[model samples]
Each structure stands twice: as structure tokens, then as C-alpha cells.
Target: MDLIKTDQYGRQIGYVQGANIDFEVGADEADSINDFEIELKRWNWDGSIRYGTRVFSPDTEYGGIVREISTDTSTNVIRAKGDTWRGMMTKKIIQPLSGQDYATASGELNSIIKSKIEAEYPGLFYGVTADTGVTVNNYQFDRYCTLHAGLVKMLKSVGYRLDIRYQEGDVGMAGYVKVSAVPINDLSSEYELTNDNNMNFITDDNRRGINHLICLGKGDLKDRLVIHLYADQNGTISQTQQYFKGAEEIAAIYDSSGSERDDLIKNGIKELESKKSSMSYNMTMTKLEGNIDLGDIVGGKDYLTGISMKKPIGRKIWTISSGKEKVVYKLEGET
Candidate 1:
């Protein structure tokens, strides 16, 4: 019989006594194939046993090296929903106003105004619209006013719909001023001045520039102004009312008669310089009405010369004469 040890699966785990064991036993006792024992010893010839260290001296037999069909049924095949397969998702909180240190509220207001226009009008985002109004006459002095003036001019230059209002009153162009912060959804209290009315004053012989521009020019000369004046007051004077055809027209006119239009242009420049010399007022507009951003207050030229009052300055009080009637004219949007 072929003697060998194997599990029920017919897979051998260990060998039984050598195939020739029984045959060797049946041989003569003396010469009984001592080669079988020698062969077994040779098979187990480990260096550890050679050095007097028993290598495989087990305390008990392990049931002849079982193969048991494993009965375990333990998982070896990985399932689709295995522990290794995990779903991963992520979330983050991104701050809209983070990282920029030099960002200003006024700057934000400017951007907001521009964005609103860009969104509202898709194709006409640029190209000069009609001159809403001459800046010299409608110039604003307060911070918000100054900001709005610049904003309107900028938007107008790029073909944005910013319908500026103008008015005239008993005292020249009274109520002919528009001043306001760019409307932001976050802030409820935003300063805005939108008055389209009229004021009364002297209609001068020269129709070159606005009254304020003329007021800035202290005196008229043969071809220029002798002395400059302050044009701080904010109102739409009559002279600088109409707009030139365009920059192209102005350029064409300049090219056609190089020194011919000098009289008109020089006169206009003088008036503008005078108006620019007028006092400038600044104001702090913020979401928190109580606290103004200190950084926004900086000194400028020809105006009040320094940061405007932290609080709003009341309307400028003026008296034509010592005993003249005290006319209470409150300039709207005075900062």
C-alpha cells in the first residue's frame, strides 16, 4: 500500500513512513536496509540540530498537520462595500473679504457701482454717453459728494446710465447738486443727495464757464485770469451747461485751428483752474455710521487742506452784508 498522510481534500500535508519502510522491515534484521534510517537523517540534516540544538522538538503532535478545508469561510475576496472603500466629502468656509489689507469701503462702493452698471447694461458697457453735466458746475465738496462726482464722471466716460440731476434756485443753481454713497445692500444708512432744481444769480456777459468756475477766477484779463479764487460752494452754475460733441470733435477743432481756439480753450482752462482751487470737503461714509474708517481721511489740495471734520459740517452760512437779511440756505449733503 502506498502510505502517505493527506486531508479529506486529497492534498498531502506530510508524508507517512518512507515508501520502503515496510519493505525494509520485512528484510533481514542485520542488513535491514540501514540506508532508510540514514536517508531520513540526511533529510532532517539542519545546521541547528548539528550544533546540539533540537530544531523541531514539539510538545505534542498537531493532528498530523491538518488541512481541514479551513471551515473558516473567512473573507479573502474584497467586497464593493469593504472597510477599505470609504466615501469622502469636504466643506470649506471661504471669506469674501479676506487677505486684502488695503481694501477701503469707498473703494468697495466704487466697485459696487460699476458692477451694477455692467450687469444692468451688457453691450453698452463702454463709449461716451452724453455729457451728463459739466463737472465744474456740479462739483461736490463733501466726501460722499466728491466720491459720487468722481464715480459719475467715470461711469459717464464709459457709457453707463447715470442720469445726473440739475436744478436752479433763487440764488443761482441752488439744489443743483447730487451726492451719495454707492448703494450697498448691506448698509441701510447711506448718504445720498439727488436734487434737480434751480437757483438765481447774476447772468454775466461772458458765457465761457460756470459761475463757480468764474468765481474761482478772481478777475478777467485780456486773454487769461489775473488772480484765482476759491470755488468751494457746490451748485450747478449756468455757463458750463452744454457738452462738446466729443473728444474727437475737440481734437478736430484743435487740429483745424492750432492757435485759433486758444482764446476759448485758454479762457476755459483758467476758469477750471479757479474752480479746482475752491475748497474741498470730505466725509466718512461707512456701514457703521458711528465709526468712520480713519484711513480714508487724507489731506488733499486746494480744498480744506486737511481731513474734513470726523462729523458732518453744517451748511456754510454766508451774509452779503452786516445788516443783510439772514437767509438760511442749507446746502444738502454737507459733510
Candidate 2:
């Protein structure tokens, strides 16, 4: 892979191609900031690589600003590490003015995200766009948190993801970062990895999950609001309760501050969904076809374990070393 060096402003400085460099680039669906690291011999250093510089890989579609750089005299190697554009968002906190507890917004998800950036730190993010085409009625973000955390929480609630990329400048113009909100695609049927296809995978089935939640709301003693919610096989919460025998059943309590029955139930449902049984898979493929990416649902089946699942790609790591490349994919909810 080619590692192109650029200034902090996204202006190309130089590039290293077919060099004996080792690097790892990866992203997690649950996180706003992705990370990349580059390690190469001291002889390969162009003397221009320094702190605040940016390195981009068009082949891997991964790049980031260099926040830290270290040189090893014994090994004669140099290492540069930093985070992607999402890291920049983490530096700015969402602070609501006096008498406010949160920074709130409503309407389209894209517009809300853009407005937050423009309001908090204008010109930091350019070409803000959204392709998810999702809209939310209302959302509130806790104060004193990074903008990245706030946006991640808002987007996850609506099943969307954030993507930020650096666009190199044209001629004398300086490059800028592009921010986008995209929908998580369901490509389970289109991409399948099974033992039959000689794919290696490990399946984890966590059975220590709660199926019932007894919610207790505001008030005291018997006057307090109380409700029971059950999670079914499909992870749906409802008032209709179902009981299981022996080890097959699990239950928990959800202490809520809701005074209304509807509000309590809604809170109960959110809590219940989190406690449902988690099933995930981890697999490493040497060669794969088609365009598969993080947040895209994929299919996997392990015949030895009798496990079949369709889950979103939660994280991916790409490593290049010794003239070989390896990519690892972990399903959502996998540790």
C-alpha cells in the first residue's frame, strides 16, 4: 500500500511507495475515532514526517493526523501514530450555556449534526453531508461531553454511522475534511462466509442474558409505579410476559425515574434490549470479493458449532507486513 504524506492542511508533501513499512489501520462501528499507525526504517524517513503531519492511504482508504512520533536509535526505526478526523471532533466539548442541562436539537439528523459543528466550532468541518436520509423528532446531548461522543450517541439511536475523510486540495487550494452520516446497509444475503466455503470463524454465544425486567418507577412503596417487560426470542420487548423453567430463564430489575407508565415502559424496553443474549462471530479472510465495510450486515455460519448468524460488521483491522496483508472482521457485540 502507498502511504502518502501530507501537511496538516491536507496538502500533499510526498509519498512512499513499495517501502518496507509496517502499519495497521482500523475502525470500530461503536466509536467515532478510528486509528492508524505507521512504522518504517529511519532511512525511509523523508525528514518531513513530524508531529501534526497527516498520512493517507488511498488504497486502504485510511488516513490520520500524526499526534505522536518516536525514533528508536537501537532499531533505527521511526513510528508515527494518531487518529482520524473524528479525533478532531473529540477535542471540542459540547457546553450548553447557563441554566441548560444539555445541547438539544430536532429535525433531520444530518442538519442537526452540521448545526452542532457550526455552532460550536465553525469552519472546522466542511462539506458536511448525510446519505442515510434519516430524521429524528427530538434528541438531547449531555453537556460537558465531546462533540464526537454526542454525535455518536445521537446517530446510534437512529441506526446511522458517521464517516469523515480528508480530501486533498486542488493545485493551490487547500484540502478539507468531509463529514457524512450514512445508513448501515443490510448486505447479509449478499455476503456469506461459511465453513463450506473454507472460511474460518469463531462463534460466541453468551447465554447469561436477561429475558424479563421488573421496572420500578417514581413514588414510594405500593404507590410506586411498577411494570413488567419481557424480551422474546427476537429481542422485542412487550407487556405480555413469558416465563421459562430452570436455567433457561433470567430476570433483572430496571430502576427508572419515569412517572408516567408510557415513559417507564419505554425506559424498560431500552434496558431490556441491552440485556438480551449476544451472539457474535470473528473471522479472518485472506481474500474476499466485493465491497464490504464496517456497519454492513454480513452472514456467517460455523458448521462445527451449528451457529448461523447475520450481524453488522462492528470492527475491522487491516495489517500489512512482510509483503503480506491480513484483514480481521468482528461481528457487532463481539468483545
Candidate 3:
């Protein structure tokens, strides 16, 4: 396990101890913001106040870069906290023409966003261009929002699911990002947890059908109930009509593009399906244990529930001067 520390200019100044280097995979909030943290011994750098100088680190993982580095000086350690490349998507605000080809506009904006970050912190990431197949239809809007949120909107405009992954590397790779995308129903489940592996805060809330997905339409499409049109026709479900106070329509930039209305309906259906079964657990794995990729499906049997499937959800890593560093994988899944 190796963690190469870099200076503000992405220079290899020093290497931190693998034993003192503590990190984990995270999905801390509802947005599933996948992040990783590095808590290491304070290092010597120039032009920066005690851990104040901006620094980026390309750890021994799969070319993943930690965009920011701070310190946990309380313990005489330099703690660097960072999120996945997706974090770049939120740092900027987006405002595209409603009539612009949704696909072209998004591609352009994504390129623009990456341009700013890549100029500073260059990593071994796979997509420095518009290789990701995410697209949105031309939608007129008189607003501004986080480009990350907008990317989610564009992703839903098409039928794709975001699949996020994080792993504390193998034999020598420490940890790296294996997957972060605008789509991932392609997730696989794993049965890697057992009593030998410590686990805490495990719970499951299974409701046969308790999802109410509502999409508000703007203008003439206001108060339109498209639930039945998109929701499951399974006889074991119930629904209601509701008003969408802030719904707006977006036409596709291309003649062969998907209908805006159809996009919204499909988006709603995805939400409902995700609510089918909910499970939560806090599984603690030794730093040397198996790999954990955020947003991937993990299947296992608990001391109580016997067997179940879980989605790796949240993470919190603890760094100690005692040399006992550990990683926690917060898993949530729909059965």
C-alpha cells in the first residue's frame, strides 16, 4: 500500500507511510457523494501555511486523484479529504440554451468543466473528454443550478443509472476508483461479509410497495398525473394524482432524440423501482480486507436476517496515532 503525496503544483515531494495512511469509500448523503480521505503524518511543503497550501495526490490506486488536501494537525497528521471525479461536476454552475441540442450542449459543458480541473489536477482517469455516453434533450430553461445536479437531470433524460465505485487497493495499489458514471443498473452483488468481518448498525426496512414518485409538469402539462403511465402495472400497488408546480418541458435537439415527456416518465419509474426494498448496514473491514466499490450491489447474510443484498452507501474512516487505521463501508440495497 503506497500513498504518494504531491505539492500544490502536483509534484512528488514525499511518500506517506502506508500504515498511517487511512482512507475509505463514501456515500455520505442522499446524493451518494462518493469521497475518499487520507489521514497521514504532517509533511513538509513550501508556500503554504500549516496544511493550507492546496495539494493534489494521485494515490497508489487506479489513477484516482485527491483534489484537495487538508490536515488533522490535532494529531500531528496532514489529513487530505477529497471526492471522486464527480466532485468536479458540482464546482461549476450551468446555463445552457433551451433550444440548443441537449447532447451537444452537455458535451460542451462537460468539456468546459473538465478543462478547468484538468488544468490543475491531472490524474490517470479514463475520461478526460466526452467518452461517457450521457446526453440530454434540448430543454429551454431560465435558471442556474449546480452542473452536477444538471448532469443528473441530463442522465435521467436518458435511461441511465449512476454507478459509483471505490476500493482500498490490492497488494500494492492502495485504493482507486473503478467506476463513477451517469448510469449503472449494471451493478453486481457480492457476498464478502461474514461474522469474522466486524459489522455494526445493521437494519432493514422492507415495504412491499411504498414508493410515490411524482414529476411536476410546467405550463399546460401542470397537475398531469403520469404515474400510471410510467409506474408498474403490478396489481399489488396503489397511487394518487398530484400537481407538479415546477415542471418544464425540453425538446430534443435531434429529430431522432427521445421525447421530453417520455424522458420524465421513465425518470419517475426508475425512482419507484429503487424504492422496492431498502436495507442499511455499517460494515467495518480491516484496511487489508477485500475491495469495496461505492454504488455496487453487495449480497451477504447477517447474524439476524440470514441473507440479503445491499448497496455500498456511506463511509467514515478513522486514523489513529496508535497505527490502527480502519475503513467502514456503509451499505444500502434494494432487494
Q: Give me the runs in candidate 2 sitting further than 4 Å from their true place.
A: 17-33, 59-61, 118-124, 129-133, 206-230, 236-240, 243-276, 285-288
Question: Residues 1-335, candidate 3, lDDT per residue (tens digit)?
Answer: 34454444334455545324444333333434444455545553232322322222333221235556665667766655565445544555665557753323434334433543344334422223545654433533225655555544444455433333333334333333333344434233445556655544454545344334545433334444333422232312234423211232111111212335666566545555655334455555444234444444454556565755445433434343345544445554211
lDDT winner:
2
Please write out the lDDT profile of model 2 over residues 172-262, one tens digit for every residue.
5555566667776777777778977777788778767888889999888889999988777766677876544357768888888545888
Please report how far candidate 1 places residue 204 from its true position, in Å: 26
Q: Model 1: per-residue lDDT, tens digit, 219-326?
A: 234543332122222422234434332331111111112233345446545545543323333322112223221111111122222222112211222112222322
Using TM-score, give the best candidate's number.
2
Score residue 108 of candidate 1 by CA lDDT. Answer: 32
TM-score of model number 2: 0.76
Q: Model 3: runs farther than 4 Å from truth?
A: 17-89, 98-126, 129-145, 149-189, 206-282, 285-292, 313-321, 332-335
> What is the C-alpha local distance difference test score of each model?
0.24, 0.70, 0.42
Better of 2 and 3 by lDDT: 2
